[model samples]
Target: MKAFVVTLVALAVLGPQIARAEGGFKVEPSMLTDWKTVYGQVEAKDSIPARARLGGTLVELSVTEGDLVEAGQELGRVVDAKIAFQINAIDAQIAALESQMANAERELTRGEELKSRGVITTQQLDALRTQAEVVSQQLEAQRASRQVTEQQATEGAVLAPVAGRVLEVPVAKGAVVMAGESIATIAGGGFFLRLSVPERFAGTMKEGDAISIDTAAGEISGKLAKIYPLIEGGRVNADVEVADLNSEFVGARVLVKLPLAARDAILVPAEMVKTHSGLDFVIVATAQGPMERAVVPGPMTKVNGQPMMEILSGLTGGEEVLAHEH
Candidate 1:
């Protein structure tokens, strides 16, 4: 414990020295491209909203934002109070009507027996028969109305129509919602990177053109999926589809490298490049000592299964660089 405490104190005292100690890098020339990098955003290919087919107050919301859902998944419950009450009322009316029909049938049987024994008149039997028929028809109508109400009640459960990640749930629990109102916004798993390119490069860009996406998971390749017909503010918008990525990039910003034309560049080992205040620099060896020179670094690439960066400007070929080891 004593040694540990001493180490902590030493680290606190040497914090500034440790931060300032950075290694230097060397530079070399290689064939590279002057590719133009345009900022792009990864978006869902088709973001569809899951809507409520029946109107009611939203209740028991189960799906949350960013939750993955499958087809036929229950997102929440909708309580249509009026429909429930109507069903109950219809049920009660059906019960009463059924009881009345039973009594009318018994009375019609008695009237038939009396008429056969000549104990009742034919007009009385005819009246009893008409009453029984009318009661049966009324019962059927009530049952049909009840079925409609029950169907409405069954539709109260909100269901997801597609398999995807839920992007947003706009309505809150206990909020009154109308039929066809969107309950959740879902991105249907298919993702694409959206690139806004300058209109000057429109003729150069074509469908299926290859591009690279710079992300936290390093760089990956994608292709142009579409080109829009309209150009806004001197920029043409297009979508690039990348495989093997989930919805993680669905609204994330990524650096997109579009091939412009090829040019000669100074290639250096990736580790040799140092950064300060977002600017890249390399060390050059002179008779006096090692000197730091600012250099604009381009896209990172592999020259022979080894990572390298292209230097866009700063040094011409064959400059002796100082490679400092940390």
Candidate 2:
């Protein structure tokens, strides 16, 4: 009789545990999503080098590093004394040509009158006409040369090539700069995130894929801007253009989550799984009783914005796991 009572107490003790596993808790198959994570940072895709078109003294510099500017805005000016002198020389040449043309015109008229009176031959009249044409050609040439010089003078004023924040000002006001040298650098066309991925995903990743970037402010949505063809150091690089990132500065670091390819993964509610001794465990109801198995967790994701954990192994979508809070 004491043995029977002891057995009854043991059954009562096991009943609750079995009942909890069977009815008190729920079990369901895990869900799956196709996504991956990659690390990267914010970068500027279009950095323009604001350069000097003509060599001269840089004057009236108005932008510094980290200053915002717009397209065609004047960043600074250059003064070339030689350009002004060239213009002055062209004006003098034009003045001389005008005087010569006037003289030639008068001579042509005199020659024509003489020929009408038979005082000079037609050959002489033709020579005077030729001199007038030559003077006209010299005047036209001088005007063309002056136009070119004037264009060079106007180009002395450095203008912003695009609308963006200025990154650097390499030249100082009143400093001498050479032609085609960068006076300032501007980050244009907005900011983008540059990501590096393992070379294995280079073939699957493509432009226009969705990407998410995490900033201090919050998470931002973005898309793949470009995929580089060349692989470097066992990885491939890509550019990501995010929405509302125009305000973001260049070289700002951000955590990026990008999808490489579709994958069939099992995900469970984050609360349903528990970690013990460095391994994940989930309770499963078996014919004998409740059982626990080790699970491999891959990544944390969201289903309809609900938090979940991805299971890499130890459970497929076909198995039902008991939901319990540890």
Candidate 3:
């Protein structure tokens, strides 16, 4: 009975160990994505300029470089002395026309009375009415001219074309600018990473592939959003879309890893490969019992959410590696 009790205790302690050793991972070829490291720049989707609507002097500037602005927001004011002068001239003409119109109506009224009294002929009264109509038309024309001048004056204020940060301000207060001159350069439409990849990978690159970004904070994942058809200077342009992308600095360079192709390789748990005397080895279970076989280990990878290491050489399919000892 004592012997049987001791045997039961030993079995209880070694049962789990024996099971793990017998259930070693079987090596098989699996697909792995090959990545290509490249540099990419943080770029805004749109870089537009806030332009002046009319030629004038920049009277007031409300924003500077690196300031955030909104679409259609007023960034500066321009003043054209000529525009104000034209408005004043139009007003004067309108006033003169009004006085003339009043005089013509009075003359027409007097002519009507004179005709009723038979003091004036009907032809004379008709001529007076025609004169009054001409004065009225002149007044209408002058009023319309005044409105046009006012509208031109209102357009002297420069407005932003898009919502974003101000990148460049080419003009200062009191500086002269043309109607289409840029007041400020704005970067807008959100931000994305623009990549220049080697032309040889064009055939393998595709949209919607997962991409890895190395930022100052940590590694973040992104998606390959677009691939341009044109190849410039033997480089293909691509765009990466990432949520929570850092846009603190425009034109900032970032390290990126893109999946260019896929290939089949053998992988095993990282712990399965042990290093001894500057050499790596793996314990392979075989008909002759466990044997330590020298192997070459490649980069580390993940398999089914577990950390794995790729076997570059000295391993074959259908081979089983023993569980790494603690």
lDDT scores of the candidates, listed in order: 0.76, 0.76, 0.84
* Of candidates 3 and 1, the better by lDDT: 3
Stretches of candidate 3 off by over 4 Å are 1-22
Considering every candidate listed, which one attains the maximal lDDT?
3
Worst 10 residues of 3 by lDDT: 1-10
How well is each residue in 197-310 modelled by candidate 2, as lDDT tens digits? Answer: 898878877788777777777888888889988889999989988777745467766678766555455666577689879988987667886688899987786544656676
Best by TM-score: 3
Residue 17 displacement (Å), model 1: 46
Tell me the tens digit of each residue's lDDT in model 3 across 1-326: 00000000112112111112335667766666778999999999999999999898999999999899999999999889998789888888888889999999999999999999999999999999999999999999988888888898899989999999998998899998999999999999999999999899999988988889999999999989999999999999999998989988889999999888667677777877899899999888789987899999999975444567888999866687776566
Determine the backbone clash count of candidate 2. 0
Better of 2 and 3 by TM-score: 3
TM-score quality measure for candidate 3:
0.89
Question: Candidate 1 or 2, higher TM-score?
Answer: 2
Residue-level lDDT for 105 in candidate 1: 99
Candidate 1 Cα errors over 4 Å, as ranges: 1-34, 107-131, 261-326
Could you arrange the candidates by TM-score from highest to lowest?
3, 2, 1
Question: Once model 1 is optimally superposed onto the true structure by TM-score, how far is the C-alpha of residue 157 displaced, in angstroms?
Answer: 1.4
